[model samples]
Target: MDIKQRILASSCATRWFLFGLVLIGILSLISSEWLVPSIASADEQSGRYLSIWARLATTTGLVVFEVAMTTFLLAVAYLLLTPRDDRSGDVSVIEGSDVGRSLHEHLRTTESYWFKGRSARWVRDVVFPILSNRASTDQIRINLFMALPDPSNVKLMKEYADYRESIAYKGSKDTWTQEIVTTHILAAIVSAYHNASKSNFLNVCIGLSDWFPAYRVDITDGSAVMTVEDKNAPAMRYTRTSSFYSTFRADVEHTIEMGTKLPKPVSSFRNRELDATFVNEILAHAGLSGTLNGAVNEESILKKINNSGQLYG
Candidate 1:
């Protein structure tokens, strides 16, 4: 039935029930007066007092009955008027936009990038350690985002321990390690695009070397050398150096050539064929193809030296 019809029916039923109960109670009280034997009295005063007491008792019972009926009727009315059943089916998909808008507004009101108050402690102690130990292969990758102010731009640093533990000892290599390293390298390349001038480039190089002391860095006008060292013994190093890049043409060539030597572990999300497709996708994103022309491609590489002399495994 419709809401209005249901409410009307319930109200009518409740009124009738209350009327019947009141009528029965009144009849019982009247009957009690007639059925009870009169008490012997020494005077008319006692008789009068007894009649008054009976009247008062009957009034009290009627008052109680009225209060109970009123309360019941109010409760029934409330239930009948209240909504029932889920409205989920009636809601449109577009209705979710309002919820999203509200959440966005709330975030905007409370948003702050700088840690303050209690959050400062977490940022200092917790986040720094977690960032330092992110890689399972005893490597920590740090990315310098493009938006940051230079003297430091387009910088990437990796600090790793020079040891390989067997998988049997629960100290094995993880499959995701290479992928994580690649991501950090990719982030550094992306950051380089933001620099408006080459003056900041040298500063960026210097900042990276300082940030990751484990990696020995030697930067010249057109070439750079980076060496990843053993954590236990800093004296030991695995070095990789790039050839001269006089122009952007030379730089692009060196970046791609260096990228080729990087290890590609089995991707969790892609099969071999899919992985090939994904690599092509990244190349396309970087606006790089297999062939590099001297003019259009700003960078060119003269040579690359990978010093594996100290590499144990």
Candidate 2:
């Protein structure tokens, strides 16, 4: 047998043996007391044999009960600690081709389920159109060094931005930017759900940066802020600040309000991660990586990009 099988077998054997030992101890204790007293009226030799038999029976009963209780406790512990795997290892052949497809499909499905559809559609139709436009295409390539605990989050965010850009510049130009903004909102929602603690606040900030044309999102211990400078509209230049608690609370409240405003048939809460995936994918296609990291104290992302030289000449 394989190692896993061997291990399983050994564990089972050990458990049974322990149960047997417990039963033996219980039997010995009973035989020396209760069994011996019950058979005192019988001949000495007869009484001794009877008492021994009684003890053996009692021990067997005790062992069975102890083994059952131990098994039950072990099963409960296993269920609590084990991470569930939903994927089935079933394969089907269609036209002699393997059924397995690209990971993008998996991402798409996950996003679809997580977002509940609206967020996903917004990214595709709105976000991508804005980011991939040639007129603003250069703005999408700005680099903001991120210090995220999980690089996968950054990589995923980047891939989604690129994907959106590709779709936006399919043929014509005039890409849209609002889509990127919407994506940032979605990514924030997703990050908040996955890592609710303060330590992960940076990830949320970085993920939101993709939407801004110029600025980056920064998260410190106290609050989240945006910083930027606007050359075209100097009047709009200023640092914007919002507490992480306030921002998340506002987002949740806004979502709840939006849900309430929707028709009864569409008023269901969606998984934040799924919504984030849709937003990320859509924004990605548009060449927008809305605020995945940096300072959020700027008046506008465009202004920050211009001030920090995040945008190319």
Candidate 3:
């Protein structure tokens, strides 16, 4: 094995060794003090000292044994009852990036990638990387349904700005206003389209929807990862096998079924018309009608994004 593997193996071995020591020490104390004992008469002081020592040792050993046994049982229950990383749904509900790892391990290029979420943060961090690495086939389709920005109502916008400043953000609330967050998401989509290999076919459409629960569907010919939403914590991501890819794919199709034409792959010169149209739509969704009307270009779009979604136009 490699050095990293060897180190990991060694570390696991050390943990087992320590646990074994705890068990062995407790058993040895029980055997010496209770199972096999010597009775010898002595003075009262010496007898009292012996009695106290025996009780202390017995108590300590029993506590150690009980604690160790309980810990082992709890760990076993967690392993058996808790979800495995490899599968989801009726199978199991594994937590954290195990869902991502398991999907990557078995992911095939023919698999379709679908994501519906409030922000595309998980898409940018997890789904994009997985597809970029594993899927090599032509005609890859990514279906995304991201929450759209609130339509421009000055009162609502001000309220949202206050809520964002008060509730949802960490660090300086000034760092990312609601509109800035939407602009960043749009920028990510634009980047994805621009950077995708032109030789390989890629059809990705991001539709704007409101209050869609976040989930990702990555389906191979054999296996799939259908992320389960934790409603109490929408940010938490977990997945089960995709028994629902078809339904999800249909849902995504139905949203785009509004006759939204897929934008052509962006480039420095080619596909400017399609890019412009797509960017305009994205800007309008972010409540930036002023920037859209002022002849939205790359510079103006980026400027609004950098200036916290305030269109100076």
Q: Candidate order by lDDT, highest to lowest?
A: 3, 2, 1
User: CA shift at 218, candidate 3, in angstroms?
Assistant: 6.1
TM-score of each: 0.20, 0.21, 0.42
lDDT of 3 by residue, 1-313 (tens): 4434543556564465456657766766765576434322233436543567776776577667767765775464334433344223433444544554555554444445554433344455445545544434434553333232222333443444455455442333244354544444455454445334332444455554433333544444434445543322222223333434455556655654542333444444233333556566545443445523223355544554334321111
TM-score of 1: 0.20
Candidate 2 at 307: error in angstroms? 44
Residue range with the least summed lDDT across 10 consecutive positions in model 1:
299-308
Error of model 3, residue 305, in angstroms: 12
Predictions in order: lDDT? 0.29, 0.32, 0.45
lDDT of 2 by residue, 1-313 (tens): 4434543656664565556557656665665566555555464656444466776776676667656766765554343333222112111112211111211122221211111111122222322223223113332231111211111244544554554455443233323233343344444333332222212111111222212222322222222222222112111111113223245334433433433221111112222333334444433432334444443222232232222221111
- Write the residue-wise lDDT of candidate 1 on 1-313 in tens digits: 6655655767665565566558656655654554333322332545554467765776676567667766776565545454332121211121222322321222222211111110011222222223323321233233211111111122321122112111112333332222233333333322222111112211111011112222232222222222232212222111112112133223323433433222122223122222234434433444433323332121211110111121212
Weakest 10 consecutive residues of candidate 2 by summed lDDT: 109-118
**Model 2 residue 186 distance off true place after TM-score fit, in angstroms:** 17
What's model 1's lDDT at 287?
44
Off by over 4 Å in 1: 1-48, 51-58, 77-313
Model 2's alpha-carbon lDDT is 0.32
Q: Rank the candidates by TM-score, best first.
A: 3, 2, 1
